[model samples]
Target: MLPSTYLPSVNRLAPPSDPSLEERYGSLHIRLLYHFEHDFYHHTKSLHPGLKDMLALFMNVGFATPYLMDELLAYSAAHKSILGQQTSQLYLSEATRLQTRALTLYNSASPQISKDTCLPMFLFSSLLSQHVIYNVSSNVHNGLGPILDGLTNSTIIHRGLVAIAKASWPMFSEQVQQQLIRSCQRDYMPIPSSADSRGECEVLLSRLNATDMKPESIAVLRSAVENLQDRFDAICTDSSHAMWAAVQDWLVAIPAGYLELLNQRRPEALVVLSHFAVLLYRVAEQWFVGDLGIRLIRLINSHLGPAWEDWLEWPNRATMEQL
Candidate 1:
């Protein structure tokens, strides 16, 4: 298992002359970086055309930090692995090794969140999250145990960013913050809130409301569901590729106690998550998410047994609509 992802800022500044990717990381990474820029990056854009702006902002954070470059190269290799390229195992091994190297480079430094470092750090963490989710989602044949473990790892990665962001929000460049943050908050503007208007979420919310859990736990689950409602209402309707942000929020901004329940695979939390998986069903062909939506809902249905079919009914039908 990989170490908990850490988005550390270097205590020391980069050298007087910023080194280029080929110059610093050498030829093997140079080719991967080439594939990422010329091929993989644009392919993602084509897949999620509406997300062009958000992705442009994401990719603008550069190889200034070697770990960020390492992440890019690793994800590039992972792309080849996912596609079942020649020597797919070699690509997978490279992807795994490079990501580990990225984490080590991050941890080796003191984490000082200067303005200069904020966006790069955010992108670093985000790329890390994508690769984790993509890697796990791609390999779902490994079974639910590892998928759950990967889900835990992905959550830990995003939560680490949330912690870092909370501590360093002021240091982040105000100019570019809205470009990303507003995409995340698009639902915040004058949207309908009553559960009746949120038809997709009506059952999920009602179930949370009827539950016998503690008020704190109840509040946490409700918060996750409600935020999920925001995402479903706004992003899912457009079939936006910005689902990356939804996945990120699902991991990071989820109500604190909700994650504990999810970690325990509480019926309530998993049911809410199953609903979200229906949303994921839209992008199933996207390599990053793979067929996770179908797989996750099926796994949850089986895991929860027959008694909970009432709760899973809508999610199951929704995915069938995709079929």
Candidate 2:
């Protein structure tokens, strides 16, 4: 891993001291960025947390520095090979930070911040696109295989689906949108070796399709779903509770309007809606167990239906009894 204290080289933006200096440093930087992003994409779970922080810092610099932006664009245009490399670096280095920054920048009132921040925001969107396509095309079996296995229980399956749907919908780039729809069109193979796991995967996929369709932007919805599907599948297959939680949080963050749309058009939004409903049911169930559960049940029942009541009776009810 690169030293946490490492700063961009002193000569980072210096005019080529020599003709080759520009070519050499530029090439090296681009290549380094590529490997860094590749590692993040393929080995994020295994990566050191400190390294992840460092990468996030670099990504901050990329977005925060005007000089770096100019250089990145110029380098990308001059050396097409370097484009993906630079993008990967910016993405893998501090992806979550960049994402947070993009949202902040988007919400900021300053024109300068908004204009300058769009590049990084766009870059982040691009990274999402790449992940969506890769997961849809190559990792489906390992990713979705296990999640489908556990879907036999309507509640689990429903929550899983909602999680997937929520992950896949909302504001995103056009490229990602198209890729998601294309991925869904592909044949789905069951995990013959793990019946329980495969059932979960199917439920998750179904739910993903549900919420994904709620976004007014069909293009954005498609791409987001593709990416969500991959992540959702991985969660079930790996039994990654933390990852699953992250997905659930993202789903919960969606606007109420979108969720309402899904509810209204449940047939078209079955995949995402069922998944979201199930997730809500689980959270409500959790609330019911702690001293807070009664209040939560009342709060949910005020707006939702008997689904919550049914969930309270599930055999897995004890799983959420503690809160």
Candidate 3:
């Protein structure tokens, strides 16, 4: 574990009650801001360099934005809660409190994505993405239904951040946009793995195509499968691409209509999703991912039952081996 100390420039950081910040959100928040940046910020950065660096460039240098700051604290606290800290309950309570407040503030804002708000909103959504996954996946006492629901929720959030990124992409300068695009495409979503999933994907596609679903539905699902294949190929062939980046990108890339298939509990859709669990399995050690890949595999397998056991064979085996 990294020490909870600030970098050399800690002296320049504003005191918790800096008049301007205190004026906006009071001394408690001012203290929370200082404590987070002073203690946890550097520590957290060491844990996820890509995440910390990205947010540092986008949000940290400025006075903490209300919602984003809450989320950062919430995420850090949630992580602490799981670390067997002596005050884990307090951290957990604070995590939940801050997370709720952050979401409320975010949802209450204007609907439109504007130049000024877009990047901040995007960063907020991005942090919230991992927060939800970490929060949901970490609490597993409820059984399969809640786990499935949590994953479904993560997928929904994944789609949302994708929308925000697409809308905000054009706002950057060509050079900066290219850099940001690389971040969004790779560092921004570290969910997939470079593990060989071609066999599983092929089975998924074969089963998908044989189904009697509507042409459009089949087409949508097929596009998603092909997208997976292309990504796996890229991961295998390209040295620059992060293998795990492909994990969440599938959820991000899939169209809304295809998600309806998952909502409807379509066997093919479930099967396709189960294959994505392979990506999760590949990166199961990641802090936010954990055993989620295995959980997703079990949920889908149990949900589909014997009828689709053959379809789930690879994903099921991949995750089960971890046990």
Q: TM-score, each model?
A: 0.78, 0.28, 0.73
Better of 2 and 3 by TM-score: 3
Evaluate model 1: give its TM-score.
Answer: 0.78
- Residue 2 displacement in candidate 1 (angstroms): 20
How are the candidates ranked when ordered by TM-score, highest leading?
1, 3, 2
Query: Which run of 10 residues does model 1 get worst, by summed lDDT?
Result: 8-17
| Per-residue C-alpha lDDT of model 1 across residues 61-117, encoded as one tens digit per residue | 654677776777888888877665677888887787777666656776544666777
lDDT of 2 at 202: 49
Q: Give per-residue CA lDDT, model 3, range 1-323, as digits (tens).
A: 11111001112211122223233344545555555555555544433434444655544523446767777777667766666668778777767767766665555553366766766777777777777777667665566556655666676667777777777778755765655654545433322543634545777788777888899999989988878776565564322234456766776777767778777878888787777777776765566667777777777777778988888887777677664
How much is the lDDT of residue 21 in candidate 3?
Answer: 25
| Among all candidates shown, the one with the greatest lDDT | 1
Q: Relative to the true structure, how large is the alpha-carbon lDDT of every model? A: 0.69, 0.34, 0.63
Query: In terms of TM-score, which candidate is strongest?
Result: 1
Better of 2 and 3 by lDDT: 3
- lDDT for 7 in candidate 1 is 37
Better of 1 and 3 by lDDT: 1
